[model samples]
Target: MATVGAGRDAGQNLCGCCDDVVGGLPTGSDLDLLREGLYGCFGGAFARELVVLSPGSIVLAGNHTDHQGGHAVACAVGSYARGIFRANGEGRIRVGGRGLPAIQLDSADLDARDGGLDDLSAMVRGMVALFLQRGLAPGDALGFDAYLALDEPVGSGLLGESALELAFAQGLNNLWAGGTLSGEELALAALRVARERLGGSSAPMWQLPVALGGIQHLSFADSGGAVAERIDFDFAQEGYNVCLVEVGDGRVTEPASCSSILQEMQAVAGALGAERLGDVREVDFMMDLPVIRDQFGDRAALRAIHFWREDRMVEHRVRALKAKDMHAFLELTRASGASTAMYLQGTPRVARSQAIMLGLAVADENLRHEGAACIHGGSPERAILAFVPDSVYELFSQGMNAIYGEGACRAYEVVDEGASAWWL
Candidate 1:
């Protein structure tokens, strides 16, 4: 329902000071990087109809808590997934992408796949299912030749899979549904796909940030639903730049190391007879600790402490962001990092990476720079996100990468726009 044009129009919403969201269009090099491997895959005909979607997400805080009905803060990032297609006129759908072979399915078989759906096929089948579930039949089938490019670091906590699913859903929905689905609807459909077929988690945390598009405070309600509130305050307004530093190369394969923590929290919640962990108070947890620990062990006690602290941290983080209190915000980041390390048991195999991250935070504070560093993602050792002043970024990046490796730090700005499409 939105439009993207080079010229300024009063009718179409513009991002910040420009007509383009996320600064501007992809740079020539950025476009070239995306197009590099797709030459032989799609000819000029298909390339001309490309529909580009918005970028992915980075969870700002409240990691590994969303699924258990806990809160989280997440935002859309600069990296994106794009697609190109035309009507195949064959009542069949085909999808092809990096490392995924091209697949074709008849429209009649949308509800029944021979062996169920993989990642790519899930997007098509999921969208079709969503349409059917809503009592709207997608008129025809169109095969897309698409490729996904992740601008974020490979092991970065950004949700590349969610980005791809959102892109595909947007493209297909636009084609079939006349783009009636809101960002939230698209995110819900993507969540269904992820849950039913792909066995992935973190839907609203990843999907809302990308779908709503921006630096947003995604508030998870007591009912386990979420609402995205656009954060109007810019980091540039406070002379700060957000950056993610790659501290390690390890990836957290699911049924991740964090599941134990989640299980422990859920068990604690059950023991308290509370519906959700967030509903269990600090007093309730502390008072019950002796009995809880006796029943669940020391790990459960420590995890309870983390759950309580993280709940408070998420609350305070929202306030800090709203107040534009960078100092308070950075302090909370350090506390979160410390809690994750000490109590939450977030070191996913490599303790050294976390140690270094904590060390950098100490150095950053000692230097009196207006910034803070913390373990970035759900996996404690993968990366660290720092809100550093633009002036100190080079010095900070150089020192961190000197130990971690070169090109380890990358900067990002929150942009306001979700999964959007423009006819190419």
Candidate 2:
């Protein structure tokens, strides 16, 4: 059996530069945010003892999982999932949380190998199945005993829970098999098992970027999978800043809206037979206005349109980064945020927060406000964020700290290294 511990040296292995960028201690507010998000998404009572696995590890695993039509992006943040696990030899699984009843699932049911093992718990089971299916193990000889922990109080815009699951699966596989896999391999393996065995809904697209770190553009076609291209942008050297601002009013629901937007965008792309909306350049807005209106009538459609166009802008940013044109890059980033607010009709909460952040940036004597940007359908509470050069991070951090109070905004040094795996 695999018995995991919250090691004494936990968090010590974190990159010093990352710690410096996010500031010292992980805030309590961050943990609260994560707890709330976990309840909302997973409906578990609560999470405790959060654990943050290295982003590098997750990224490496995610990349290795890539199939003909799969790609993932992930980031290792300052926070992680918090919880503990104990193996029950009685062929039963029991989970408990605050203000919630303990959830029990029989190990017999899990071992059935039927399609019913397709829920969250099944995700863990699927990893085990994959290990055996791949001939990496002789049998399900051991069960998992684990405790999840987190430093970040709240879930970031991305599906952090799944990220945690990926990390846990990786750690468990390593421990049980007494062997190591590259990060990319683990990520791909987990993704495949999750989709095929656990019935996960999302495409394997978003997983890689978060795993790998740095900015990336992803594309998926047909039923094949997806591909990712790293956008070569240097936030540290560039004279501008990138920040993610939270719109505290809470109108934005990322998972709910992002899926709809992606579906609509896909339909448009499929109908046009173009890779993305930006491919339809030089068309008069007035000429396409009726079609655009018919297809995407609501504000959500407008937001999707903004994403399509901004995707093209991201391509431009990629070029500018290559050319080392800092001015152009900053301008594009700001323009992207403007597009989000004006075209996409971002939530009022997000708009207000962004305006507040912009004001703070402008007032800063040392830092110039290059731009503000928000992901489509990002959590309304944390709607808008920005990117800034490393030179100005120190100068601008204080202003953000004052506005965000604590645990609101964070800064991280941009790393050029793409995703890869390391083992202990």
Measured by TM-score, the strongest candidate is 1
Q: What lDDT, from 0 to 1, does candidate 2 have?
A: 0.45
**TM-score of each prediction:** 0.83, 0.62
How would you encode candidate 2's per-residue C-alpha lDDT over 1-424 as one tens digit per residue?
Answer: 1112222222544343332223222234433443454454345542223323433212211111122122323333333343433233344444433332334565345453444322445565666557766776434434433433433322455223445555555544444444355444555676676667654444445444434445554544334344556656555566554444442434455444444555555555444555444344425433565676687565534644565566566567667766888777657756765675566543444433454335434433335643434432234324344555666666666765666566455554444332221231
lDDT for model 1: 0.65
CA error at residue 10 for candidate 2, angstroms: 14
Per-residue C-alpha lDDT of model 1 across residues 124-209, encoded as one tens digit per residue: 77666777778655455444455545454333354446777777777666655666778887777787777766656553678777
Clash number for every model?
A: 1, 68
Residue 328, candidate 2: C-alpha displacement in angstroms: 2.4
Q: Give lDDT: candidate 2, residue 31.
A: 37
What's the distance in Å from true for residue 293, model 1?
0.7
Which clashing pairs does model 1 show?
Answer: 213-417
lDDT of 2 at 301: 49
